[model samples]
Target: TVLTPRVTLQVVLSRQYGSEGRFTFTSHTPGEHQICLHSNSTRMALFAGGKLRVHLDIQVGEHTNNYPEIAAKDKLTELQLRARQLLDQVEQIQKEQNYQRYREERFRMTSESTNQRVLWWSIAQTIILILTGIWQMRHLKSFFEAKKLV
Candidate 1:
């Protein structure tokens, strides 16, 4: 289901049995997002009283699957479902690999730029040191000549 751009969600539920609930949220942006909902009951023992486990899986953009009902209505075979899953996995893997490459390229460019700046700064410092040394030597020579020591 395509949700509106921005909407508020209010969820209220009470657990009676050892049942579980799952909530899935998806957005348009690509990448992985996790939305979880769990029950916190301190009155009951850790292993006792009914434990409520809520597993939430959210897939965004093209990763979202909205054709399960349609596939079921059409009575798709097991092979069809397996093939669809494989294709989706392949596509997701390709997108992830491309994103990783983009990050690496950006990191490389930033490193090169920083290295260049450091090299220029070092060169400037060397030039300033040389100029200062020359000026000090000239000033010392003039002082000695005025005092007739050289």
Candidate 2:
């Protein structure tokens, strides 16, 4: 099972998928995805093996598509197949660009928030320093007068 970033659960294979299998899924949003595998092994089996071995090969974007299979299924000519490949590549490039834009927007927002906090902190620090200086000056003047030194 795969947990998409959007909180959607996609069950690739509910039953045993044999020795080798391939599953493809399209991501609607650009974010981290979680893959989970569960086995129905009994406690004794689990203790004996200590671990479950899984070989997963994940290919994202256009590489996941089988161009040869597509060409054969569609009975496409060489030129048509080339065109189809180009179109898929272009679509992947667009998705990549959109993801980059999303990251840039998030980074800009964080930078602005940090800048605002730093500006307010600096202002507060300056005010505290000014108030401390005034308090010390008044205290010194009072002490000198009481001692008859001024």
Q: Best by TM-score, which number?
A: 2
Model 2 misplaced regions, further than 4 Å: 6-22
How many clashes would you count in candidate 2? 0
Which pairs of residues have clashing backbones in candidate 1?
none
Candidate 2, residues 14-72, lDDT tens digits: the string is 43565455666666656887777776655686677686777778888889889999999
Worst 10 residues of 1 by lDDT: 5-14
Q: Which stretches of candidate 1 lie over 4 Å from their true place?
A: 1-63
Q: Write the per-residue lDDT of candidate 1 for residues 29-63, one digit (tens) a residue.
A: 43333333344566575467565545545455355
Which whole-number lDDT from 0 to 100 does residue 103 have in model 1? Answer: 82
Q: lDDT winner among the candidates?
A: 2
